[model samples]
Target: MTHRTTTGTAAPESGAAVPAVSRTDLPGGIRVLTERVPGVRSVALGIWIAIGSRDENPDQAGAAHYLEHLLFKGTGRRTATGIAEEMDAVGGELNAFTAKEHTCYYAHVLDEDMPMALDVLADVVTNAELAHTDVELERGVVLEEIAMRDDDPEDLLGELFDETLFDEHPLGLPIVGSEESIRGMSRDTLFDFWRGEYTTPRMVVAAAGNLDHAHVADLAAKALTDAASRFPTGVPVGPRSGASGLLRPRRALALRSDDSEQSHLMLGVPGLNRHDPRRTVLSVLNSALGGGLSSRLFQEVRERRGLAYQVYSSHASYADAGTLSVYAGCAPERLGEVVGVVRDVLAGVAADGLTEAEVVRAKGSMRGGLVLGMEDTASRMNRLGRSELDHGRQRSVAESLERIDAVTPEQVSALAAELLDVPLTAAVVGPYDDESELPGALQDLA
Candidate 1:
């Protein structure tokens, strides 16, 4: 179950690996990405498993996240504490996280400790001793995680948006499962999931910092040589085709006093997905609208009117569904005005689109940003791995550059019209006593 290694053209043609654009394949399909930094003595290695919250079934909502915790508990040769001892002994730090679509385990270590780091990661992932006691202990940790998200209004808003957007689908479920579902998780359950999905070919062991590709692959092979299995042959599922909608726009406002500076408001609309052809144009469109400080929303709302300290608009594209979002922080009294200003900006942009100069600057910022960011090993690994997950084989940086460069003002305008026209679902947490205006605000979208 190994794949052919591919190196994107983002790296310098010479031996110097520009950040992580250089991709090299190793035996067993262990991929390599690198960022060659001058005077640096270490490299950051990431063994990214192409599995995450979205991969969970109806009964295994939190299995991916739960498995992430257990991977560090113990392996065939080292205890959880011992794993730490070894990394600490070598001045290396290790950690992992489970995201909506993938789970990543990473380590930053000096040049000499690469072998040991690889071993520790491999033992934990391949030979985890997922004991019942470890599973029970970690279950509490995950529950705390769930509680934390529930307490934050902004977080809850996103959760609601997803639930509403994908009403009857898994795409809308939270990354961490519900309390009851998390409690139902077991060791055998995670093991079964891991065995089925965590095949050698479906994963990438990316190393940057200070290391060689051949050596890393050799170590990875030893650690994961036995991990050969046929990838599940399920038919590809298509994107959501039903009428896109969100949760009931109810007045759910919760304000608790805790010496806070400003309230955070998370407003969202249905967004596009990764496979959409309009993605490149949307990137530039989002940039001009609310991507950074110099955007239209910031200029109109903050600079001109001084309504809020922060305001931005952006989109999150996925494999099936997406969400275009607006985030802001402001005084309780100014929330209404801020909401109005955001709506006006969206309406204006959708109708008139951005200026030629605005489009140029946005694309320039995006182009320069992409060129500059790919100068690291971890970044290269992430780009290649992520694009591969979405578009299959790694695409050249030149291809990405051309795509972003080809975005026209008309394209951006059309996307804004489509996305902004969707219903606006918002979640506000602050001193918002007057709930009568929310309906008007929601109707103001587009």
Candidate 2:
């Protein structure tokens, strides 16, 4: 079948060079995107699948991640050991990760080895054996992973926080399925999930570094030939969108008792979704509030009073929902003071917004971070895949920087006021057995 290709280049900033980006639509609705970077001897290739943990039914919890592990076990054409040895023989890296929204199987190799990299990745993603024995073996590994998460205070706290904020929503569930879910997951269930979700239209093959777009597209087409034949022709799936229906905090507090000396606390409110135009404003607000050492929370909670050893604020933007949260770890005895200070800081921001100078610094930080982060092929490859998957198109660096620079102090202040005013949801992981034992400020949240 004839394939249609389209190409474009990122707009370079003044006196700067940017990579040329291109896309190809192949048979079976598979999309291949490539970015050609100059002066790089290596290529970063990734097979990005849109299916993630949130897409699974309750019974299929953690199936996406479990399938990620099984895919590397072996394929029809190669043994697991052979897959490892081939990549290692060329000093290349092969790995995969599953997230709440997507999964990626990627490889980093010398540009001269792009063919082998593409072929290996395609084979693994499309032709996984998913043997019953492998499923059983991987089940134990996933259970151990869940145990590991439970053992870590901060990790457990994050899960608890999500549960408090999102309630019974799929987003609230742990990406690494619960211990019960993994044990009960049968081989047929996982195989069905793999077959249903890992389709050509749901996949994007992206590569960045020293390579030709046409060459990469051709290689991808050749590599996925047999796999494409199995699926019916379709258009690429659009970016995920839907109302999360999470308009308010489900609960005021979630606490997990752990006998740790330091307490981990995460207090947050729902923020904007990924498609919000004011995301730039929220980013600026987050930066001034807790993004760096100069951030308000850092100075107030750590530097001014020495109440906590580490403190920061962060935000997560999903397709239809997002969160703005602050996390601090400190001595168990200092939990009350830490919570008070964080509350005060957030209140102050909500009432007045960031200062003009703070907004300027935040914008500069955002711009610098954006440029410096793209210096590597891996980062570029990731950006290409995420942009295509998240927005269905590439956004130029110049455009992003412009958006950041255009954010004014007023915009940051307004966004801060709007988001921070929501009723707060809190999570704590420490030596507190119940809500009554928590600090007064935390108890007040409940």
Candidate 3:
């Protein structure tokens, strides 16, 4: 998913003719959310499940991602080829991904073909066969993906960073399990994980773009009736909750030596969760620090020094824990200077926040990004689905904007002081034999 700053302007007063959003909890714990957007012929539908890599035990590592692959191979009614043919007939898109806290299987198609899309999605999510033959075939594909990740310097650095920061927590593990785990996994093991985790209570169905709430609800009802009957009755489970206090700063830097001209390193610290009110403040601060071309990190690291071609800062928030990280890929010999500038900038921010002018510009950038992101049906649908699954309710575009608007420079400064004051954890990948051989400043990282 693309990283977006979701803050916008105030909404129109009540009684205005605006897009309509509706929610319903059908029988058997399946909840549905739909938005009726005017003047578009397309529809975006998503089935979001509240199970991800973090939910797995050490033995079940990668089961969620594996299931994502196998489900598209074939369902009870549609063969893998048949599924592809059906999607092509309608000129539709069908894809899915697994994250740390959840997985989403989504499709985009013309509104007229909504019924077919819903039916196919229901069939795959609810009735996947998970056959032994399919399992063996996908195993090789997953191994190849792992190999590909290892071959990329930035990707490998990212994995090392997470592992080092999160330590022994499940959040520390890679979403795609190691080669040993993937190769040793059995068909029965995946089947069992699927049966327990893929319940209706753990799912949300969200739709947007030229859709009628009642009509889409009916279509969904008919499609999922059989699957609903199979599910046990209870209140739907909410999104991933609670913080992993285990995500403390690492004492020793994690180094992965690679034969590359440029060194990829991330300097990060633990941050707030999704429910934290400070998240809004964090967004504003992140935009000013490294969210765009004009950000502090980009301007100082690239424009002033001309040390590297790419430099940026990013923030990731899970249920309870989060991270603020700065990434820079520079020549192996220039790594020390790049790391020094970043450390100094971060220290300055922690000591004293951004200027009033910087804060105003950052807020405007965030607001523009939020408004523009809502212009497309796909982004709108994603916002609805993710909000409902992660937050248990949806905030109106206006509401979200108001929160961002309410943020003060004081709030941002305080948040920076609290989060950035902690010791930094670093991950580096480049042409170096070991930590001892790295630059002097980087070697003492703690």
Candidate 4:
């Protein structure tokens, strides 16, 4: 196997200099990327797999997440308890999560323990012993998790909104498989998925904080040796791209009637994909609209009217499609007023965009958040992994801040006109029997 290396440093900022990032592509398509933080002793390392729930076939709804839990159950050299004990001995943290497009197994340890951390993480990802008992054990656990999500109004509302907006696309499916699918999943099916999708070419190793790029790459290469040898040489998978063939406003309203204390409502329209150049503009607009406490939704819906205790707008970008939505929880009787206020707020922004002052404040907020959030090693590692998986390139903090600063009011307005002025999709979870019992504003949206 051969190696290719590249290095780049970000432009310096005020207090601390920006860290330098480097990448090494090894034979068999495994890529390792690292960022060296100057004043930190802890290292955050992750093995990022490119397959996620969205990659699952219909019958395999929760296979990716199931694999996440099963990987921690046992591996070739360590039992689940042993894995926990070793990390605890080092006072380190080891965990993992499955997303729409990827899954990550990560650890945080003192820099000196990085080699041990990398080895354990690699073992968990590549050498899991997915026993039948473990599969059954985790199936019950995942089902309980789904039940927990159902019990949370906000969580259930998010799922409902995605279903309404994305229609029948896999992106609309819950990360946790439904009860039927979970019960039906067999051990062999999961093992096959793991062997097929968890290849070196579909993986990235990222580490940050008080680490050397070459040493980290060396550790990764050694740690992943067994897995790397199993596959023939291949090229790393490019970033996910292409249209999300979703029909907009597939259904205007999706409602789940529950006798809860408050009504949960989500209203939104189709949004730009992750690759859209206008995404930064959308970010700035989202900030001004609902990204923070001073955002328009908070001011109009909560501060002034006292309509609801919780109200905000958020946007999510996936590989091919995205969503921009507003969420508000209020008394069942007050759902109408809340909907009216949110609709008016979005309509006003769509019609007139944001003021120059709002845009400036949004940019400053974004810039500060970006810099401050990177104070931890975990955040830095996440940035490296997500950048490589999503765009196949690293974007520096300086470049990000510059892009945020460059967004003009005109650009934001143009995007808002394009994204927010369309037909809206709505999802409701509250004490309502059907659409007829809902407020007229929501019905009008439908």
Candidate 5:
């Protein structure tokens, strides 16, 4: 069986069938979202928390990510080694990640092992010991992580792009804070941040596999019973609502001299937010622009001219704002030619838009991506958690596919014009000693 919309009710936007999804708000304000998929013996469970890097203040910086590491270090009942051994004994995989807007601690295990997964997840998330020695040890690890990122040209360029594009906004900060920030982060500071942010209202537990919704709900409820009083009123905190103040877009050029063999560049403009109706159209537009080998940017910059070895287009959408960008990694000497070709392709698309054939191909690719992504329990669990957290409602797969099918060429063109007509921001990381050495096209873009 496929996934469902949720328990409260199915809000099917299309006549096609949908999975029997269930959502329950527990007595302590925890949200349980479950989808039962047949023929899958393994279950994927994730506890999604709304606190992420964007939720932190300047001083708090990487506290959210720090907590992710510390939680796995040890809990009240399980030492770090014990936690690892238990998961290994069950042959289950437990992992977690921190993002700009959320953090997730997830596990992939057999259906029968669901009890152990829930217990361990609840203990680590709610009752972590965050000992001082572990804090100091993990601090060194996070610093090495930051250092590793610094050594990667592409990763560094992306961080630089965000810093330049978003300016002072918290969204601009990297998921792993800087060396200075990580070095200064104290154990007490992280402990306090964890206590304040890890609330019932800010959390959601999601599972998908061959499991019953009511049973999963009960397991999660019992696992989290000790923390119930933390939410005395049992009032759901609801989705994040308010102005993110990310509207201010700083259009400029940023250069980070890496003395690398190739120049990595991203030229982009502000795009749509998560809730924008035209986001679907933007997806189609992105595909046609540079999403695949058949895309315009790839064809013009890599296929025909062979100006760059790699060239593509991508975009990111946050709650408040987003970005659409084209990336090209080429020889430093060929940087000018690469930038010119990419710019020309973008300008051409903005002026004339994509052909009907291109739009059709993009839509098909998008539809395939949507359907193929749900072939596993882990992906389905992620979809359930993210949809409930982001939109406050689960959109059915059929309905989503229908929306993609309905995106007309006119819709794509309009969105392209709206997003591409603005002044662009460019970020380059490579062997450039001074800004004057940049290509004329890149300088003009700047």
Candidate 6:
């Protein structure tokens, strides 16, 4: 959903073992990788094309997304309805998504239906009619999606942060382009983008669970053999030159009209890029900050202060850059105190630093969580594919844990200091207008 393309970071290939999945180059330039995970009844296959919102020029806003919809409307061999019915008949779940640097269509199905899933997915990507009629109808649906995001307070605020952070870059554009751009989109424009972006060499076909090298390779050969099309080499993506935000103090309030029980407040700042070696250290630091019920923000804000029902911190690193955010929900009456407790914990970590015991607990939590999560086939498959996308190859679970273990308390403390040093950009979605009374409202931290 978000584009994380960054420059100078190590391509994911740096630390990864050659994946267990065998890789092959097909006729059209598509690359396929497959691995067999035994004893699972289901198979998961992904068609990952290297096109996302970040590739869009401002003029083309949601063209990639529009193309994604047309892919399923009708392929040469399958009608739109037929595509859906055939998959459901076999209890197969098919889905697709657009992100900053990739568009992925995936399926989870009984092993026997793997071939069927591939045929359907391949057709959707390569043969959609993109007829004027289908395009016109879907445009309305997409517009409604745009409206929904604006109404969703928390989501809208994050979008605001991204927009402000990457003002002139493609990263600032929403995945679902503006209404004006979507309305202007023509079938030909959709076709041109697809023809230029979708190709065998630029694609990744990854399948895991109840599948083998032969089956995956065969599927890849059939679906991707004809996908080759070439374009000029891309110029590298650049860093965002924009400042952190547009929310001026005593200006218009960034509240949303949600009649829900609690109000949500979110604060964030730039963090690190995906390939940064200290990512593991950042991870440990994030967990200690507000990752769980036992986390510092949770302990101070929710348990002790009894202001917020929830509070958590997260760090997201992209190829080009990263972000660290803290989000919380609380009653309107308690918002001020909730903000105070959160600030206290943040300031405490940034100033005094994480204790030896705290760092150990965070490390155990992060490393232990990784080992426990890879047990499921779907999780394992996605982990591999996303890691490949973000980092190049997948790190073995043991290797991931080793990195976590190597993160010293000093590293975490240092990262905590770095992340908190910025003047925080805060977005609160609730009933308040001009929340000048927020605790720790002054931007200073550490």
Q: How many residue-pair clashes does candidate 5 contain?
A: 4
How many Å off is the CA of 367 in candidate 5?
0.6
RMSD for all candidates, in order, please. Answer: 4.9, 2.2, 4.6, 2.6, 2.8, 5.9
Residues 296-337 of candidate 1 have per-residue lDDT tens digits of 988988999998887887788767667777888887667778
Model 5 regions more than 4 Å off: 1-8, 12-17, 242-245, 248-250
- lDDT assessment of candidate 1: 0.70
lDDT of 4 at 96: 94
How would you encode candidate 2's per-residue C-alpha lDDT over 241-299 as one tens digit per residue?
Answer: 84655557443988999988889999999988888879888999999999998999999
Relative to the unseen true structure, what is the C-alpha lDDT of residue 83 in candidate 1, on a scale of 0 to 100?
Answer: 91
Give lDDT tens digits, candidate 6, residues 1-446.
11122212222434545345555545454556666676788888888876789888766789888787778888778888999999999999999889876788889899999999987888888777788889889999899888898777667766665665555567657888888999888877888888777765556677878877665777666664444433223222222233333322121223344555677877666777776778888888889888977888888887887887768888766567677778888887777777676667777888878999888888888877887886666676677567656655546665777688888988888888877765666666666444454434422221
Q: Estimate, for each residue in 1-446, the C-alpha lDDT of model 3 and write its tens digit.
A: 11111222123432322246777776667878888778999999999888999999988899999899999999889999999999999999998989999998999999998889988998889888888999999999999999999999998988898888888788889999989889999998899999888888777888999987777777777777877777656467877666557466555588998998899989899888887868999999999999888889999999999988988888989998888999999998899999999999999999999888778889999999999999888898898888878887677877777778988999999999988888899999999998987887688885
What digit string (tens of lDDT, one per residue) describes model 4 on residues 211-324?
999998888888888888876677899899856655464438889988799999999988888988789999999999998888999999999999999988899999888889
lDDT for 273 in candidate 6 is: 71
RMSD of 4: 2.6
Model 3 / residue 109 / CA error / Å = 0.4
Model 6, residue 167: displacement in angstroms? 3.7
Please tell me which model should have the higher lDDT, number 1 or number 6: 6
Instruction: Please rank every candidate by TM-score, starting with the best.
Output: 2, 4, 5, 3, 6, 1
Q: lDDT for model 6, on a 0 to 1 scale?
A: 0.71
Q: How accurate is candidate 5 locally (lDDT)?
A: 0.87
Model 6 TM-score is 0.86
**C-alpha lDDT score of every prediction, in listed order:** 0.70, 0.90, 0.85, 0.90, 0.87, 0.71
Q: Model 4 Cα displacement at 316 (Å)? A: 0.7
lDDT of 5 by residue, 289-350 (tens): 99888988988998999988888999888888888999999999899988888778878888
Which residue pairs collide in model 3, if any? none
RMSD of candidate 3 to true structure, Å = 4.6
